[model samples]
Target: MGIEAELITAADLPRLEQFDGLLIRDHTRIDNYTFAFAQRAAELGIALVDDPVSMQGCSSKLRQAKLFEAHGVPTPKTLVLTRETLPIVPALLGLPCVIKEPESSFSRGVHCVASEAELVELVTALLAHTPALIAQEFLPTGFDWRIGLVDRQAIFACRYHMVPGHWQVVRDAGTPEYCEGRTEAVALGDVPAAVLASARLAGDAIGDGFYGVDVKDLDERCVVIEVNDNPNVDAGHEDGVAGPELYEAVIGTIARRAFGAGR
Candidate 1:
């Protein structure tokens, strides 16, 4: 907490060596400059939150599917849907399933299909862009547990309620009428053990870095939806329970990694 920090932009790439660590708060994409910054930071031996490994693993649903499977992380029945296998959606995942693009975020590039007609139509449209998609068994729930983890340890846990009359957390994001549901942060100890365990498994599957694992608790069983890097830690939302300690832990981890990891 005693460290001095300053915000840097893409144009400040030359100045990267001046800092001991970099915390990337911007939207990260493999093809974007944010990832390039991470690469450069790693090259310069500067510690980074959402390291390159975490970014690569968390950016794609296809990779996550395999990662979870390899590590035995509990997740909904999922399959990689390609154009060749479009007809098997109903037979495999059934109707009312959830479809997600590999690089989807903030509820964009995701769809809920009700019937075989919808499944074919949506997957057809989506495949035109990417060769594959993710189809999973629908787990209907009122809210999702977002557990924040740093270095594979639970830091803060919160319930992200679904938007009123919507199935996802956010509705019409990136639009003028965009809206999202409420967030209630709970103490880490108060979170369900299964939920925390699922999040931990997910974090372990990914690299040991900052992660926010989304888990659904249904029928008294918890299953991970996905592992995300650079998860939101809004002022009054995720910090409601952990408060400043959460921020300090995150910052401290980055500092330690900066001075400790391969430095």
Candidate 2:
């Protein structure tokens, strides 16, 4: 793989034809330029890590909830909350539940509400941005399992501990705060069978591509939280252990697809 990769911006869309493959690393939305780039790459027959299908599938938590249920993947009880159904969320999911925007990521648009009044306030505020929201039964897991998958295989594993005094992995109050837990690389074979199976099932439900499957393990029961595309793989964080091998696996897939070395 002697291919040279260069970083390009939205301005480089016209020049994408010169590249052999396109690995979209931006926040993708159906109406955004990233989706346009994926479409362009598809039209040009260039290899893409996260094609539009994966992007759209992973971007919506609402869709993920449906997928998890349809695929028999275990997940906490969730319901789509609208202005009409907002009043019954407490009865449906109970107090101390979690509310999330449909397209939220990095735990930015998520909130833990303990009462009906609080839920209404948060949902009303968030509804200004999105049409509907998700209310889920609160599962008090101190940490969540982040299983990185490439081509439907688990490549890396870590526990994303919740921020101290917060309920989500990433805290985005007045100032955003991330987990201080060290990423521990667990061998695929060493991972819990149920967790690995659920991760694979969740990733496959989206597509065969790069994904970070978030899961919560309570006792021996494992449930899928969400599947994210273009997941973080920073130098010291996600790539702290077995950095080269992980990078090679992702790049090799892209290169092989681009060069047509193996189909």
- Best TM-score goes to which candidate? 1
lDDT of 2 by residue, 53-93 (tens): 88889888888788888888888888988888898888888
lDDT score for residue 10 of model 2: 94
Task: Please list the residue runs of candidate 2 whose C-alpha ends up more than 4 Å from where it truly belongs after superposition.
Answer: 173-182, 261-263
Task: Tell how far residue 176 is off in model 2, in angstroms.
Answer: 6.3
Lowest summed lDDT across 10 adjacent residues in model 1 is found at: 254-263
Local accuracy of candidate 1 as per-residue lDDT tens digits, 199-242:
99999999888899999998667899999999998999999989
Candidate lDDT scores, in order, read 0.91, 0.83
Task: Give the TM-scores of the predictions, in the order they appear.
Answer: 0.96, 0.91
Where does candidate 1 clash, by residue pair? none
Spell out the clash pairs found in candidate 2.
none
